[model samples]
Target: MHPSAFLRLAALLALSLPAHAQEGMKQQPAASDRVKEVPSIEAVGLSGLKPGTILFTDHRDDPAKPENGLVPYLDWGRVRPAERAALAPYAGYAEPDYLQTLNGVSKRRHETLKVYVAQGRFVVPRPADSIDLASYATLGFVAKMDPVIKHKTLNPADVTPTKDPAAAFAKRPDRPWCDLGTVCIESRYDLEGKLPLGVKLANKLEDGASKKVAEFVSFQSELRTLPPAETAPLAGLTKIDAPVTGGLEQTIFWVNQILRFGKFLAVFQPMPGDPAKTVVTTYMALAIKADVLDRKQEYARVPVLKNLLPAQVLMGNSSFNTGTSISAGLPTYARNRMTAFADALAKN
Candidate 1:
């Protein structure tokens, strides 16, 4: 299974554990441990990020030169006005159309997309005394972004937008179904007269395929339709509760067919020696399954005339073979997002 799917399954399983078992799970290393300890921007071969400026670049000062590579860093409030303006549109969060653009790039099999990762950091100016996580949350920054962070169902057109120059491709989806996060799991739906959405969706795919293939597609289809709150086994959730916590790890699940399983994370850490300043980093990890061509050779010569076969016959199937290519661009997307977030934060 892909890592994202595995994590989703694990989360579901953990939610069903008894209270004592849940407590034991919490005792283990916090999920925050997964956050990489990036060096301060100064030590990473870069300097002079203005106190409130936000910059986005690879961990390396120069991607082509390893000797001058810089490690990831998350600190300081040095974003510039121009930069902030550039990222403002992205600051609103969950731009499904923008995500579709990245997904579109990955779908181009002829492009030979390779594994990619990018890391960046930014600083948000804080009141002089409000530096800790608690203070930051109390200030309403988290609340302002809460709804924006959740997964939103987008129109299929957003994924493959029309070419009309006058079209409005940026309009938000109406009545987007919440698929993940606290808002989704906590919301009460009026299902009184409606069939269970999951079963209704499953029955739609039960036709027109061999048993094995039908079962596979059906299962995936169901996952895309069911709310993560319903499919995931998480317990102890209340309608009034906000799943977010300062300095805690949270996940937003993507439940689209083209992109079967993926995880998006955003973390906020306090800057050292500056309690009022906070460093926020966002991470995205995606797993896609697709088919690609691989070069291979297979003998086309018949047994009786093998020795007499022409070169072309002997080289049949040598040109290319079909195989799977799983590319990861989530990290790059996350880095781009952080750059924008920093800029937007600076302006705000």
Candidate 2:
């Protein structure tokens, strides 16, 4: 990244520090000693939402109440024979091949990364009255990535389908990732996660434009390896994988694919005991500059760094779902880009 870009990003982030940004003369523990905050399901809010509502959050998990019993949403069993090859790249970040084969700008830089996890929930209308929420929310919408970005343009042709991630990324992207790294185009994706609707739910709605809708819902995104720092805190997240009736997975890129960025795993299921309202749990771990994670430093040499820092990663709606939008990371930055996403999912 250019030096000037970093300055702009640093300034943007300095201004973003919430009024309550943590500060204690470096009283905080070392990064390794730190813990991943996994908000409880209760704090996530389980009730009192009107049907077709999209509730979102990037709140920290309550460490004191430690959540436990979380396994991958589409653990080994959920994988099928054919999908193994196609999903290898998206789910194989832990393997040496992933880093070894990384090409273009998305290659790993060995920077200290800070991962963030967040979730969103909403209720499907009882009568299933609305646009094709599944199509809008899932994958294969590359041809229709409208209303997503403000300055950049992506060619649907560049988004070809292939199971081999190593090969795909090895090839150069025909388009630029962002405009000078400003919020102009906060983030982009390599693989889009899909949360397929079950027969019970699919039967009620009109499937949208993507013929790939069925695959999107069933396609589950996952991580092959997570830093111990991230996993240790999640060991007790018992309900982390709960209520996951269906799953999807995808990976993202930023700043001209300068970094592999991160991957996203999400699950969709009926709210326990409440068949009408559906819940979505999205988990993501991003590779962020540990320097930027420093609340006290002026660490923004990258143009788009302000889009999301270690403290508040921008995942969820904008970058993870079917397609990146024209107004991604917009309306707000700290929160997961779910507002536009919710608007798509909201039942009519």
Candidate 3:
């Protein structure tokens, strides 16, 4: 690291130490001891016998030197022509653009970056028929986000979004959060019912061997995360119980949230090398609230912060990761969420 960068990071750590110390005064574990738990895509896949992949497909960053060289980041624009052609039909809209920048966020409310994208691929060997395409028709797409409070269910209805930000703030009403001008909440849908205005969608997939057409399912719902609390961060995770779309086998899911918009999909087909096993190709893209990047770019630009903090920062595992800037938080969350979704589909 450059001397200047080291100084900047040191200053940041120094500035944040007092608050971390203050929290310790409350009798909770030391900030460094806290660890948020998240379902790892790899772990989930192995648990259900599935293969998964996560790549950083962001057009803005250099793939040669990802945040820590461990984070999976891929940009649609950066893909080679041949690889791009292979994934084009399925790629759809999951690539990120470097040019948009999403600048002017805090200063002028400018959204310079066209999007903050995330991508993941996974394989579920089970035939599409084994997956519960119908029940997913009314599922709460937010549940699979698998980052904050993690997976709670497929239900979407019975969740009423809170419109009063002040009231939500009051629920936990902790000082550091309000003092910081924001909070994170959890999206936990455990009830069963039809999502408001949700609809069932069907699609056709050709069986490569038989040349026969098969049916696939997708659905949409108006979902709300569980009420705000200290344990799970939900503020801005959704656009006030945003309307989301999802599906099973040949899986797809998209969420429209206030802070971030995410879309992920997996295409299942027979693997060429092994005719008996199925190969699933997956992709996803998303955009985040510009103003956020504006405020936290300093912390996000740090390498150690980006690497060690992605999953922790996202799942709100600890107050420290929760407090660090999460500008590059999507990849870890994406990988885990995609795997969780694939595992669920494999079971159904």
Top-scoring candidate (lDDT): 2
TM-score of each: 0.31, 0.40, 0.38
Expressed as tens digits, the lDDT of each residue in 223-274 for candidate 2 is 1223234233331232433333444444444323212344444445555665
lDDT of 1 by residue, 1-348 (tens): 255544454444334444553332112222122133243333432234345444333333332221122111111012222222112122232323222234245321222211122334455676422434333222133323322232333333332212232223323244232323222221111111111221122223233322211111110100122133331221111111122123322222232222322333334445555556665444333322221111112112212111111121111111110111111112323443454445555665
Q: Candidate 3 — which residues are off by over 4 angstroms?
A: 1-110, 140-260, 273-275, 296-319, 322-328
Ranked by TM-score from best down, the candidates are: 2, 3, 1
Give the C-alpha miss distance for residue 25 in model 2, angstroms.
18
Which lDDT value does model 3 have at 47? 30
lDDT of 2: 0.33
* lDDT at position 204, candidate 2: 22
